[model samples]
Target: MRSRSTLPCCITLLAFALPAQVINKPAQPNKFLEAVGRRAALLGREDGNFEAWVYPIKILRDFQLSVYIDNALEPTPLSGLAETVEVRPGHVTITHVTAAFTVRQTWVASLDKPAVEVLLDIDTSKPLKFRVSFIPEMKPMWPASFGGQSTGWNQKDGVLTFTEGMGRFRPVLGSPRFTRISEQIGHQLPDRTVMIEFEIDRSGRVPIVIAGSRSTYNEIIQDPDALVPAADTFYREFLNRTTSVQAAGLNPSYDWAKIAIEKGWACNDGVGCGLVAGWAPSGLSERPGFGWYFGGDTMMSAWAMQDYGDFAGARAALEFLLDRQRADGKVMHEWTQSSALLDWPKYPYGYYHADTTPLFLFTAARYVRQSGDRDFLQKHWAKLEQAYRFCLTMLDDDGLLSNQKGGAAAVETGALSGKVARDIYLQGVWLGGLAGFADLAGWRGNASLQSEAESRLARAREAIKPWFIQDKGIFAFAQLKDGSRYEANSGWQGFLIANGGIDRALAEKAAASLALPTLATPWGTRMFATDSPFYDPVGYNDGSVWPFVTAQTTLALFRHGQAAAGYRYIYGMAQATGLSGAGFISEYFSGDRFAEGPRAVPHQLFSSVALVHPLISGMLGLDGDAMAGRLTIHPQIPCSLGPVRFERYRVGDAWVSGAIRPAKPTSTVDIEVQGPTLKVVKQPAPCIDLQEVKPLTPGQRGQ
Candidate 1:
């Protein structure tokens, strides 16, 4: 650790680094209205089921939010007859005009409560009856019961409640008498159809409320009287959380990433708050995969949240994970929700991952880098010190992290599980942790630690190539513990590439080998080649396509000067978020070499991280050394997307924003930075309106 006498210097560095210790701008209400989707529409609220998906393109199997008209037997096919499906950040509007009656329905979900509000306007000549239904696939643990029949409520209560295990779903209306029970016989499907009859009485408006509850069962939650106001307040407060960032020259990946981050953002009663990887619907009970708080997820989410100016969420997630670190500096994988601890006996496994601890260090370093919050560093320096020490112990004489060798600790799934060698993925992370430690050490002026970390990083870099790089244009997954090797094209290449400072020819060959059509998907890179004997499209790790890996590779591509290729991967990741209309990236996709995946959670935090990172690190190329009061921007504009602007982007205590307009036929970029105190340390691109940054006054505005 650095000497305590240098504390004042650290404080001075931070004092010049940030505008204020805490941002105190009075946040006025934000009227957020962004329409983003392809086949399905994502309704985002900090409340509700954390997601409400509507399939407007093809309503054959719309997941959560569904609509039915008149005949329950022949339900209305919304996609086939739908005219318009308009989405705003606040609500979703779907209008369908048929030969008989014209139905216009608006779906508004509360951002503050566990409820959805729907307003329907019908225009018909004859008496028409239609029903609106909400069917969620609450898989597993459901030899269940449905209908408005809870402990005290009945069908006469004009509500629909489906309760099983510890969870409940209630869809209520004030003036309707609803009674329907279509329970799943084998619990294979959530076929419990809860519908309220809407008899078209001379084209009038009808309101409906769909409330979903798991642990929240208070008077306000149970009361039908408060649903409307709850929704109204929710929309107002929730809009403030939504931000609009035009990707400029890029595709909708930036927008989708931001949306997905919001979708997967979760908070549980016991575990406090963190980003869940994804919530996949299965035949088994709803399991929050590393949900309560996964160290990896928390670490990765910091990238996305920071890129999108959601530092509060990022900080919350970071603190949540840090609070649960084990004594010996091992960061546990997850701290599950109270429900997981209560409802299931097999969950809350703290250290299922060997990569998580290093990843935690990576995230913390990045947070400090972006936030310039040396104050945070000062507070957590000892924890960081202990973590690095633990890492040193984990390293073998060969410098590889050996704890994950031939165990369930690292690479826990697919064919890689229980392998007899250390995988390259661990090395990639080990390298990242080394880089982070060196950077932090340099910041604190710890000469001995900085020299040691640099030396370790250099030795490992030289050592890995000889052991892992094979002659067949590939990097071996690992050198087996038995002195053999596992030769394969692993997605770990991205991590190695992104860590930078690798041999150019070796890194280039490794990157090109993985880009083969057999292993690359437009959505994400496959974990293994399709021709591999162990390849399974849906295999946990063998052939699965992970969007986060795609993102990591995208950053690596940028580091290797393949910015255009990196942009394509960004497009693929953005498209994956639209698959379920949940605006969340799933855990992994079937490695059929497509961008989309099935059989995974819908909203992996790193999936969003995949997007958040590239926009800043790749495209805009903004690097901030808050400690040195230096900022740099390099333009990596692709020819296809044209010039773009990233407005109102935050950099530590200040906001440095500009547009990337093409300098015409020359293929150069005309970059411009508006007035700000951020001093230029390295700027290759031509910039306009650069200004000298002064220390921020007491009430300067920067959120």
Candidate 2:
């Protein structure tokens, strides 16, 4: 027998270098801003409110306000404030003077539309204050660089500051008596947009500060300690430079929320997934026949697009798989368009396994539902049919798919030789695929095909139940012919429930089993239980924590009325692995701890699968009742979040916007009819009685 230690190497090579820390440039001309503004204006009529900003770091700039007004009797004291001015480099400062106001100013630039940082040190205790206007020049810079690219401005402290190389700059205060009241807030506050009119006092000192504007704070505040030090450093440096002051009008029409979403999705790798985590250490190298197997790297990226309703992305991935399907109907284990061979040694005892086919089927079905594009389905149906036929071929006399050959044997173990085995994972995949096909058939209106699929699926489920049942509930994986049990209890089994292969009761049992400390890990779901005789924390499949499996399992539990448990599992993995902080999911983490491995693979596609599909199916509970031509949804949103909104989504034939609001202990479910005039039902049952709608014409046949 091959020792578990000798697993095949599965590596990844990122196309780009890791992002570097950004160095802020000292006060300088805002060329990038000017360029962006120019571009925006050219694209549309100059609405004056059109604003452009850049961030080398993640920070919320449009939050909070401090306004200073000249209280002089002369009405012109605030005059000419609308003119654009620039702050001299290393000459701006801000100092807190009293609870009511702070001192801030900079040297005015002499040119037209000069870049300037407007400072509003508001007196929280005052009632109403001044009116001032000017083109506010705000520059925010990140502390990191993209390779060796120039560090751009990003929001640092509450105030937007521009950095130049090693120099730090901010609005400076000339007087020492100014008392700066640091908003002792823990997390970075969100940006808000407000419109306020102020009164100038006789002494030229503005007395009141009114909340005026609002906008979204794109910066995500995770760790207070980690962010505060950097903020303080920037603030202190800004206080050292002082000169003049100015005020700018608020831009009300800009939409920051959309910008944030776009930015969040920008990190995606063009190959169908996002790299939420950093690149894998192995570097980019193609498998002998497979184009690229980033392991869980590409897999985890699937979720980043889910919340955004990126059906195009989902379809691209399905098409990739469909195009790569083999003549035998079996999808390649893993391949890139550049390569013809499949890579399967990554998972031992599963060479050209039956599991891959089912995964492909599931993804394809999802694509068809989201797009409602019959052309794509018709084009890929042959591949789909072939794959299903191949799966049928794998079914043993007992009606369960069995693995007749184990994966490549490690060189130390000589040649490979072992009795054929049956993996529970394969069975789960088979069921998932069957269910997916049934869904597709219903969508295509093929009543006969749908019925045939449903029958086959029922038989498949019945054949596996006896061998899977155990005193504890369901066996994780079973033997090929006899009812021998495989000791490996993994989160993958939980996916069967999440994927809708099994009922809620069995899913709950599987989820409960996942809580075992032996199988649980800080990073995510461990591949196998540590207490198992074959367990090895460092072994590839023996004890590794695979994020992809964890995501799938979590989704399953959430769908089965175990939302809290599912959220806990997902949140724990995100926090422990620092994946949430990084704003991305990784392929896998160390089994013993959450530290990322040197061979850490990034941009995994399946890892994000949990992020997207589950939110729709589990959280929102959106599904098609084919026969009724209706859409159903049961939303169970968490308490802390505000109304969950989806911008543009396709349900049947119409596009619609919808929100999910939680109702105390019970979740609120709502579905809006957007497509053709169709039935809308409130019940939470599947459309089992609906007959599949058939194609209207010969061209639509099989589509």
Candidate 3:
């Protein structure tokens, strides 16, 4: 939870503040090949440029075969592999294959394109087997020398070799043989991309003979007469084994969510880390370089663990945050290389913005509930206490948490400059955290803390009302101080409402007002209003429809009893991003009319976690009453998704297994309540009082 005073300079310079035109311009279509599940179609070539829409996914590996004639007898330069060939509308003609092969030449394609189909018509009857050699994209000026040393490359005979120290190259070839090849290719930094070369032998054995990069010194000799086979074993294996989720057909948002999760795991687990932008390491590290602020990684990891019931992963992430808590109960914005607290020059060491603590608290509470590990709470109570105290201290004289620092931008530096205001998003986090705390406290028999948390939550709601309500609708983004408004139609605002911070009436108003045709793209809700000055379909936080935002908003809609609307949004987002073999989700999509965008950036983790909401809230209809350790099971399956079944593990060792099948307009849901099973009562009878739902402690069995 290390907070920084200045927003990461890299984020501003590299991510946000780039020129609008450059950011908004259509992403190069060829880049889509790098993504995993992209469905690339051979859209008729237009004016020499191949046009295609790539369905996004996390790519494990890719290979290409290039065929061309050597026109010049003199040795031609084999440089700039990316720029050498022109991809014409109908077909890409390879003009050269270097000096190695005179009549027939072969090369592996870069993983940057989504789907590539070779147009060559070679005779199948002949023994002249086409060899496709796969090689990682190598750029000049790479294999940088660090620690004042010359990092050189060596090729003895036909074996190309490059060496580096720990925190260097680690190849992930998706197989055991590739691991050895990856070792030969220089060491890889967590965030940096590295290339590996695999040769297809004449006997059709695609053994990766060498997998190292060429040194920048140009001292290493190129391999001549290298054998390349047509069949790429790794890619074929990946394509053959990976199966996409069935939900992908009916829901684009969920599909994207699945893809994002897969990619995040792939990158984090060293499967395909260098491809995606967000999840890839910022530097070399044994652990995936997950940022600490707002417990973003913790929340995402929790979402990822939902399906498999990976309580250990959920616990480890929670522990990571708890271990970093400051004495004053605040989480830091960022951590140093040694895992020490990042001390921002301007901000107090322990001072924090509002969201970090609350997110952590909620996530921690969820872990405890799912695992039924009271011991963990006992061990981390002190840290939780400090966090709660910090949250309570943030409340202003008016009951709402005050942005003592300059809001989100200042949480890092701890400086209170510029606009000294509160934001609705932060408030939502605070209230949500408080709600989680209230639930946890009630479960633990801490009546005092629970009551106090309830009072604080009530005040927060009261305070938020005036600022968001305008023209009988909820404002998109709101400034806390004096109730001024900014960004009238924001998906974030919808998120807060969907999460239960806003009242039902207000939630409905916000949903109705924001669901405009212009603002709601085919993928999901746009990040910004269509009329806003900053709206750009491709720009991050501008108009790009992020699956993460869509997922949260859809969950919020379900919370407000607008389940149909929630289902529609999730369905649309999933459909827009077609499923890939990797089963991961894309980070974002074009908010403009185009169904797709540039696909270079692969799967992300947070986007994938968003997919779980529909499974939990819509398909299973599992709603937890945290205080009572009780869950209400009401299945509301969409018609298109005919039959669905799942098992959900809940608190107190209770398990809820259920199936939902279509019954004309309505669906019939049958749930088998296991563990300390509760009596099944159909809805429309009077709502059950909280006390009536008995709380089950650990080891309790249902009759």
Candidate 4:
């Protein structure tokens, strides 16, 4: 690791290198609001599923605040009761109103403690009592469940404690100063709830805190108010450590994406520490809808993590996956948080995905290229080599990676089923992995290994070319088990092009096909074209619009010089950020509407990355190799975005900040650098000469 003492000297050197006219003021923090009126009252019911992590041990996933005015048994609805919900980085404030009183509840997940705090304030004419319910499901995340689980509860003084799984989940609840408090435990059909009552005079404030550990419980009950502010400070400081974007069209959503990605970072005591797929309320389901450590999802989102300079978090994710690599060198697909209670690895679910291994290699190489962490590469080189060798074993006779060896590819359980022989998506990820391995070998001075990887990559590209059906203007989605082509034009093509390993002509053709209305939706690009035999608007993988897939497709367009066509999808994704949940992106949306499905998660990690990665790599056009000490800027900023500022973006050991103003002849760039010596390169690009880009026409069919 580099010495911290050298930072000042590097900053001094960078100060002299920066342009004289460029100046940057500290960017302001972003906030979001969800107004819950009569018409949009259902929006208030969407749970933020706010979570807190106390490092490598516990995670507190608490439901949204449910208020009960007077003596109502259940939490009241917001049709005419609540006004608005304001969501910030560290906390969420919900304002509930009635004819007799106005109650404001501020919900926070302690950054340093395994607890969640809800600060309550009431405004009324006389002393009145009200109830607030919290269902802290003291259970592990999805895919790992405890059979014959036992539960116990105890109440001492004003604190109520709930325990389960032999003290594995000991949740205690109480307040510091609120004296007039009483508690009740209600046995709901599916989930147990703890209801606390508090009486207030004309105007009073109270704190309702729930903690998972004794240390946290004691700390919170003593200084409950401090936890909320401390969490706010923690988020502000965390944001300072990473990058932020400032532009006209993109504000709060960009910052929201930053928090969305960071919130996915989870650490378990013995299992491992890394990024979970996403989080949602575990209402009646065994899992919180993909709330488990996934190798493919983590590696996929690590690109966005690197885009915003969260190198440490990204590295930790890589280490987490490395610790779980199978004996045969294949990266494990998914590991649940509840593995400690069961024999998880003995099951077949961990290595079910064909793409995770290659993604591991690809993401690792990308991390090193961006952060220039050669020590990491050196330490993990053996495991990475093993993963590369494992990839070689999966290649079919045609040289393309087959999905039938030991794992499934793309569509897991949808209308498109059966064992896939070789899919373009897997081939694209494998090619990227091969390219990454080649680069790593070259860096390690292994010329023979580099040559072998390069030769195999060339062969894979040749194998994939025949899969493209020229008459259809798109590539075959996959080759079936019977050696027949499934020639449905899919958004999966975008995944192949995003890696830049495919032929330029083929990428252009795929990008053009992506523009067809059969695949492109008003919200985002559908996984499958609407006209397909297996098209289902709400199907998980058939026709749903996943933000990550949309992002990859849009990024593919930008990579192949389809800038105008790509901007529409990017804009649609940004808009979707506010459509369902404030400061969050839904996991998937219907191909026909702007809404998410019944079981869709409101705050998804890769869905958030859809906003960050595309804006950085696609719009800002930045590619950095810290080891080479070179930072290249090839911007394709659309005219609709107006002037753009990319602040505090990190390239290896250096902090790069820049401003872009799109123009006809040429776009102007004002950049500043801090930390490390670096060479800046500005590549020539097609001059942008368009006005505000509008949304694409809906319901149009493809040729």
lDDT on C-alpha atoms for all candidate structures: 0.55, 0.40, 0.44, 0.70
Evaluate candidate 1 by giving its C-alpha RMSD to the native, one decimal: 11.3
**Residue 430, candidate 3: alpha-carbon lDDT:** 75
Q: Which candidate has the top score in lDDT?
A: 4
What does candidate 2's lDDT look like per residue over 45-153, in tens digits?
0111112222112111212223443454432322122122221121222232344443332211111111212233333444434333222222221112222111121
| Model 3 TM | 0.63
Top of the candidates by TM-score:
4
Q: In what order do the candidates fall by TM-score, top score first?
A: 4, 1, 3, 2
Cα-based TM-score, every candidate:
0.74, 0.53, 0.63, 0.87
**Which regions of candidate 4 are displaced past 4 Å?**
1-80, 133-137, 142-156, 176-196, 689-691, 694-703
Q: On a 0 to 1 TM-score scale, where does candidate 2 land against the true structure? A: 0.53
lDDT of 3: 0.44
> In terms of TM-score, which candidate is stronger, 1 or 2?
1
Worst 10-residue stretch by lDDT in candidate 3? 14-23
Q: 520-559, model 3: which lDDT tens digit per residue?
A: 6545677666776567776665677777677666776655
Worst 10 residues of 2 by lDDT: 37-46
